[model samples]
Target: MDRIEQFAPPAGTAGTTTDVGGVIERMRGFRSHWPPGDGVAVFNEVYLTVTETLGRHLSDGAFRDREAVSTLDVRFAERYLAAVDTAVSGGLPPECWRPLFQYRLHPGVRPLQFALAGINAHIGHDLALAVVDTCRTLGCAPVDLEEEFERVGDLLVMLEEQIREDLMPGPDLLQVADPLTHLAGAWSLERARDASWSAARMLWRLRGAPPLAEEFRSRMDAGAGLVGRFLLTPCR
Candidate 1:
């Protein structure tokens, strides 16, 4: 099955529109349904903040290509939101998302891991595909959106630092030698962002050949899933 078909969102879950405001509303809706510490909610809250900021940036003309940036941001958020919908409805989420949902409430899985696993799936897999989606929507090539991609990526990198600080448990809850710190430090958003850029370029190149593109996308999904599973490995 195709990526979207593999884990279809329930009827009526399709995004109302791709505007920045719409994206934030959809994320907020998910946040309303899931608890503050739920794996999906953890990521959604972080992403919601990012999207709201991007919306503000759009109003102020912070981007040289506002339309391109908005479209890319909206499309990227949709993929993550769809996975949230599927998980909420008891459907099997994509493998890349399975670990986050499965280990969401495990006592041994730190909040940092929950946040990073979501980042892994979204950036390592969804991002590359999102770039392709944006290219299709804009009738342009990946090269055309490279600047916007970097701008979006920079936002993510900045968010990564804040998420760690915000989600970290109190000093009383963690020891000086906590294993969770080691586990969390193992993953890097910068490395993932660089790899995603390469993956996006490759997918765009293979766009003319459906079979090759599908194969590449499948491998990328599986590879990212493995990383997510590793990131979520219990570390008390």
Candidate 2:
């Protein structure tokens, strides 16, 4: 998945008119196995990025004090996979099509389509905490981690924005931003982990398909901007 979405493949990818054949033949670039379609590629790629990013923090005991948060992160991964399976087995109904975006090239593009949003923000936040810990461990100041922290924050926001239309979380979706206010102070490891898990729950739950595009066709009108924007900020 990462292979496909990271950028244009060596031979480039399926263009705007890509059919299943084009997606399978042209899509390229995973560090591992290459998926067959744009849907699978993009959704899985983004998910991999998010998970690996969070995993880095989890390894540092950022989640050591919060068993529940750790559990939720694990659970969200499992559930998100299931949701994707469900969508693939039976393509989304018209009302639920927003979950897949052709241009994203990363798997798991839907914000509200799956039950994973709650953990998304939380994982990102925990990742932030890990960054804080790493910096401190390396003898860097909190101020030194500020730029890095905002990068993760921007990532969380992008995840939120991508899934926004799919889940339609009302105003509550915006609440995740509030945690940013507290980021100035290096948070307790446990607090950061819990907050991250909480926000992920909210964001991932918005993963249901809403009417948007067709199967094997480009649906993301401005996907380049969405992800380009995310990259401009930086997280992983």
Candidate 3:
């Protein structure tokens, strides 16, 4: 199957809506469908919390360019929403998301790992596409959206730290030699953030070249998925 075949939306809702609220609503619906502690639900709860925070920040004039921020946020969110709708309807998620969906309930994986893995896929793959989508919607260059992108990225970084604290395993599991600790240390949201910024720039550069752009995006998606699979490695 194609790399993105994993992210196909359900046949009925496939790209049927561009409304941001609709996307969040769908996520909420999905959240309700599963138990709170379920792997997918755990990540969804963290994500929904962050998304709501962003919406509040946007409402209070936290952004320099409200229109641009709003556009980027919506576009960024739609990609994830599409993935959920697809998965719920029985479609495959994207390569970057396969590992999470496959191992969402693994007994060996902790909630913190699930959160990080989900963030890895979303920020690593979804954020870049969101940037391109925003640029297209705003009729501007990627440079024009840099400030907003950094702002969103900064928010995400902070939220990630907060999530770590909230989802951290108990003191016993925090041992220096614990596999979970090693796994947690193995990935860095900061590094992922930097890489995503570079990927966005690179993708924007190739926007005019369809073949090259597709190739780059596919590589990015696959690479991110590979990282996600690693993050989900059972560590019991």
Candidate 4:
């Protein structure tokens, strides 16, 4: 059996009320396994903040369909966790996740780069599939989950801004001439979200054709991986 398969929820299982808390705990556990300066840890910290915020919002009755949103969030998180497990067990993760795991220990990559690269892999690749997974588990269509998708996406956009503010270099040192500035500017979370939505719709439409769906997913995985690689370019 694949190493990542061990983390998969049982067939036909939906996200439970405890799933969000479980996700938070798993992310926290990564901190103990990896130092603050580790590339994977850098991204894990940023993701933990977003997950914690989402959990709070779920508790506050922020969504129209809390169950659907919660399920989507859990499904979204499981993909990254699966990839992490796969890498830890000496198995290859998806193309979109390879860059972060491979360069996780490289000293030259900055924290901000690690954060964005992980975001790129998650949003640019995993998110669309998560949407599809949620739709399947809920027995609903992608259109049915639009509200939940937007609300979750809004949280991500806010987090992306905060990540830049917190992780980016000081303005005095982040001039246009700096390669880091250009590298950071080259990717946009908003654009990634839009593209993921389009991909989700496409994947949904292609669901009946498994071969085509896999092909599209493979292409997306490779493309996101390419972007992640470029984002991780070491510029010390």
The per-residue C-alpha lDDT of model 1 at residue 124 equals: 91
Q: How accurate is candidate 1 locally (lDDT)?
A: 0.83
Best by TM-score: 4
Model 3 spans with C-alpha error above 4 angstroms: 1-20
Runs of candidate 4 exceeding 4 Å displacement: 1-18
Runs with alpha carbons beyond 4 Å of true place in candidate 1: 1-16, 170-172
lDDT of 2 at 96: 22
Q: lDDT of candidate 2 vs native?
A: 0.36
Tens-place lDDT per residue, model 1, 20-90, is 88888777666665667666677777888888988998999989999999999888888887787777666
Residue pairs clashing in model 3 are 6-92, 6-93, 6-94, 7-93, 7-94, 9-86, 10-86
Candidates' C-alpha lDDT: 0.83, 0.36, 0.81, 0.89
lDDT of 4 at 138: 92
Highest lDDT among the candidates is held by which one? 4
Rank ordering of all candidates by lDDT, starting from the highest: 4, 1, 3, 2
lDDT winner, 2 or 3: 3
Question: Which model, 2 or 4, shows the larger lDDT?
Answer: 4
Clashing pairs in 4: none
lDDT value for model 3: 0.81
Q: Which ten residues in a row have the lowest lDDT in candidate 4?
A: 8-17
Q: What is the TM-score of each candidate against the true structure?
A: 0.90, 0.31, 0.90, 0.92
Residue 17, model 4: lDDT of: 32
